[model samples]
Target chain A: MDCWIAMCVPGGASLAALAEVEHRVLGLGEALGGAPWVVTHQVRAAEGGHYAGSLQTQRGEQAVVQFAELADASGGGWGLVDGTGLVRGGGEETHMAHALASAIAHRDRTEGRVVRFPGQADLPEQLSLEELVERTVVEDVVRVGVAEDASPLLRTNGYVRLELADGRVRLPVIPWDDGEVCPFEQRDQHPCCDGH
Target chain B: MSGRHDHPHGHHHHDHGHDDHGGADYSDLTIPDTELRPADVSRRRFLQAAGVVGAGLAIGGFAGPRPATAAPGGGRGRLEGLVWLNGDHHIHTQYSSDGLYTVRTQVEEARRHGVNWLVITDHGSNAHARIGVDKVNPDIVAARSELRDMLVFQGLEWNIPAAEHGTVFVAPNSNELTVLKEFEQQFDGTVNGWGAGTPANEQHAVDAIRWLGQQMLSGRTPSALFLANHPARRGIDSPHEIRQWQEADPRVAIGMEGAPGHQAASIPTPNGPGSGRGFYTGSPSAASFPGYPLESYRTFGGFDWMTAKVGGLWDSLLAEGRPWFITANSDAHSVWADDRIRPPGQDNSAYFNANGRYGDPVSTGTPRYDRGDFWPGYYSRTWVGAADRSYMGVMDALRAGRVWVGHGDLIDGLVVTVRGSGGSNPPGTLGEKVTVGRGEDVHLQVRITPRRTPNAHGDVPRLARVDLISGPVTGPTGDRDAMSAPATGVTKSFEVRGGGEMVINHVFRAVDRSFYLRLRGTDGNVSAPGSIEPRQDPVGNSDPWQDLWFYANPVFVDVV
Candidate 1:
């Protein structure tokens, strides 16, 4: 059995600090002895002159982790939401499963593919994250470890789609480029002069 | 003073119709007294009123007279009557969170660098709206009174909702502070939590422009102007948004920056910051307009891609017969390689949140080469042709698009005139429109005075080439996001040689429809095809000093 856990940490941090937060979450998963995979890291512009982000993760049911205690350790402003009922395997229920598989493959640096339903051959080899969601059916599930090392695992750019109130939002999962910092999250790109 | 002084060198060739416009005579020069406020009259106007019109006309604060060199066969007295005031509208002070200079320091530096007028546009934020706007006004007022020769305006760098930053300024007056403070509190994106990319937030931007127009209509401020700053840097100022801003209030939201600041950011290694020129190295974000291409994120020859691309966004706006103009300025936050740092023992964040500004910066006695940006007027200059050297005069010129922009002191003077061959109507200069019968012959005359003195880099920049770009007036587009004017291109290129003033002429034999013509020149250090050729500036490591360029406003030839 699998369970989904959604956690949102309040307060704004630099890009590097945000990355460290993600690392700490992954480390917590390893300590719990559960194969945990991050689905998406949704960073958004928040009030009070900074940014706030939410991270959603999937873990094995056997891991009975104290989520409330983890929230306390990070900071006071943390919200935990249960995603178990919303996510399931197969059919339209496989949306979260595909999202989870995509992140797992991207994290492990393995090949991943979306198992398309029947009568969907005309779709191109690669699609934008938005186009993929609009074109694919509910039965399609993303599978990992499906191709050789030369080719990209997922048919689309590395974006994890999260279902929000305003439909599906895609966030880019910037891959580790041999320790080269992501330009968007450069350490030196601090808010200077009116918080640009 | 009314008599014309002959040049020492006998290279004058006044062959082409100098008699029509009175032949370089200073006696007939009339100074318009309608808008001249007592305080607005300065040394420049005194020189003009004294009938000092010749090659020895002292420009700004430079000592002595620049050699009066005329282009052979060029029209005489092209720059008579109007005073060309060089200025920078978008500059930051200590009020900005990331800025360091005081209002006095920036003003003195600008005056020393030959900037006749400037605007202190600190960023608009929650802290700024709360206290910074009111606090910075006294400094600006003091600078204005102390340096009566320099025109200092109080403005704010508006965080336009769902778009890029812009310089929102009004003519200096008693009500200037109140209007700006109210505008920022009511409309700034950061102050109102409207920084997201949504339709509602976009509407907020349009509404803000309209509100400024309302202020002008209600006579709160004598004049106001909003020029988008670094519009293409973030790729968030979509075509529709720009179009909407102009449509909302063409008087207020007149144009955008043709080139952005932070030019020293890409000056290679240990000597500079080694980042992208203009600090334009970021990729597209989720909030960015999807229509913008990858190359639009970088600067070409230290200019924004929107203006650098010949027939791109700027031309697209021009084709619609919109009064959209472009300017260049130093969005100076912290001067590059300047020996200044924030005072010690001040927690910047805590202090800013509490006091609405950082403590005054102190001299470190060591230049910080790792920083970015040049002082105002050190690199970029927006030359506005005003009737007099007044606050309203400069604002009116900017609003009328009677302006030209340059980098690295590429040219000292530029005069563009478009005339109908029939000679039935008066000739139109930059930002003016000439109405002529359909199918009438039209010609463009460009007179460029090359830089006689060395630039800040101590190198006299030579104008190697001048390009005459034109496009037809195609009316409005159904697609609001349209960003291309396919018919616009470099119609003519003139190879400039020698150090003397150069004049290039091009004629449109029997023009059929309405069109507009503009001019741009380069130093020949960097070369590529026109915008139609789809050439883009390379990514990063562009030394702004090595590749200098200047862009002049357009002159429309309307076929009646």
Candidate 2:
């Protein structure tokens, strides 16, 4: 095998040895006699910007690819291509460096709908589903007023955290505003509560 | 235009720094408690060339008396100084394809600007109810007898556009609209469904807002109060907005606007260049930043559910006691432009220039004061809470945050303390950023009264101050490409990568809205500046359309 340019050691990271030397250089010119000429495989990524993905090859040589924005490096961590020359490092190509780091962690195309909501305050950046869209909706006046401290018994930053439809954190107000009134959050706190 | 006009604002108190001290007319022009917000640039150019007497507004009340003293640190005692609740909700009189501004000059400028209330909501698509724009000013609610002063209500603002948010009200009637012809005849598309109907979604405007919230809970309509209008916006079908309700049909949406045109900027505490999250000292998008949209040209200019807590939607709806309420609106939108002020996202006009930058060719002067011109209500106002000066006590104190807001400067004796307790639940919980990351969501203190007011562009407004923004929630991470719902994308990635820091205070929320920073004069623009967006970019602000004023009443975490 008279190598014109070949180094695909794909064994993982360094991009799995450049996908096992680009599958042993197209099976080494059909096993190493030479002459089909033309297998241009290039693998890169020296540090960060990850750019974000788009490089796959299993036999379908999509290689017209050229990237080199990482200038300066050579204790063997390789890298430094201003005019374009040394790409080196297949040192073997382990299955296309895990298929290009799992396609550089691909994932793109999402408009909405997973609804995982639970913490981060169920996140809509501020929790609001609009009662799913609406049915009996009503509001005449709820006015609670208190940037904290006109009452509620003072200090500790004070206290009043409510929403828990299922698991329970309930508290609609017990020693909340000041004794005698603590409906604990209604649904069943009953007639002001004597127990029922 | 002759300086020495010290500062009383809104309906004018005029101090011009003691009108130059012979002592009688009060210092004709000395105003220096550090210029207490600016006596026309400290009498320097003295009203530029003396000449803004345009005046003429006066309507239902306050074209005259009511100053028993007290504006500097204003009505203190329990701290009632910054005031704020003043309303407008939406207006557009001739039924909004472009409202002319009437209904007696929108209740005589909400009673010659004394404003304690003035909803007249308006805009449902306009049928023109005798055009009083719904009504509400009885001489600013009969000068609240002994000068408790100014008020007005009637209201409307339903503007539904097929619903994702947008609701506003004062209601007793009307949703106004027709021409549906078919599309199941309309409901969520609003014909007056105060309950906001449901179930229609292939998107014909959310199925006409679910057939107009089921024809307003089946009664067909009336007895209104509704809210959710700017509950963090999102429409044109559904960018997936918020203001919630639909657990089968909860109705009236309840309140949330947090602070609609809310000038934006606060939550800064910790040494602040605007607190945290947003690294890349070298470049991911940093042209510059000392603390503000001045982060060179980008980093955070507006979108404040008081600082992104809509990711928790008022901390899971106030933990559990669900009574939920909050307000502040200017939602204004009628423009011709030579300079009406408009700029952020720029729908009603001004402030959209897709990078090339606009007016001043895009950024002509120092550090940024970019006043090429757009306008839009000028800067700030909203404090409505009248019982005698009524619009149903300013929509029952805007459903009930009691309300408060001030920008450019003005507030007198507005108290709001957290955790010390008073008439209701004080025992545990009040979140936003996981309620201050579990320290118990409460820590706000404000006290105002500084003078130097004139924003809608009479110039004068360099510092203004007052912010209490907060944050913390990230856990969800399943990744799905995020557009909101990774718990609202962890509220703008927690301070935006710096990981945490949210405290925009000067007292805010539930009636304690305070102010008084007032810096006045000098177009050097650094405390909150911008200029760039010559405009255009269909779906490429990168993915930003949330900031209809941050998300109402932030404060939610883990919630159980």
Question: What local distance difference test score does each model get?
Answer: 0.67, 0.28
lDDT of 1 by residue, B460-481 (tens): 9998888889999878889899
- The model with the greatest TM-score is 1
lDDT of 2 by residue, B210-267 (tens): 4443443222222134555443322121223232232112223444454443132111
Off by over 4 Å in 2: A1-181, A184-196, B1-87, B90-106, B115-119, B122-156, B159-202, B206-239, B242-256, B259-327, B330-404, B407-560
Query: In model 1, what is the error at residue B458, expressed in angstroms?
Result: 0.7
lDDT: worst 10-residue window of model 2 chain B: B279-288
After TM-score superposition, the amount by which residue B330's alpha carbon in candidate 2 deviates from its true location, in angstroms, is 9.9
User: How many pairs of residues collide in each model?
Assistant: 3, 193
Name the best candidate (by DockQ). 1
Q: Each predicted model: what fraction of the native A–B Cα contacts (within 8 Å) does it retain?
A: 0.07, 0.00
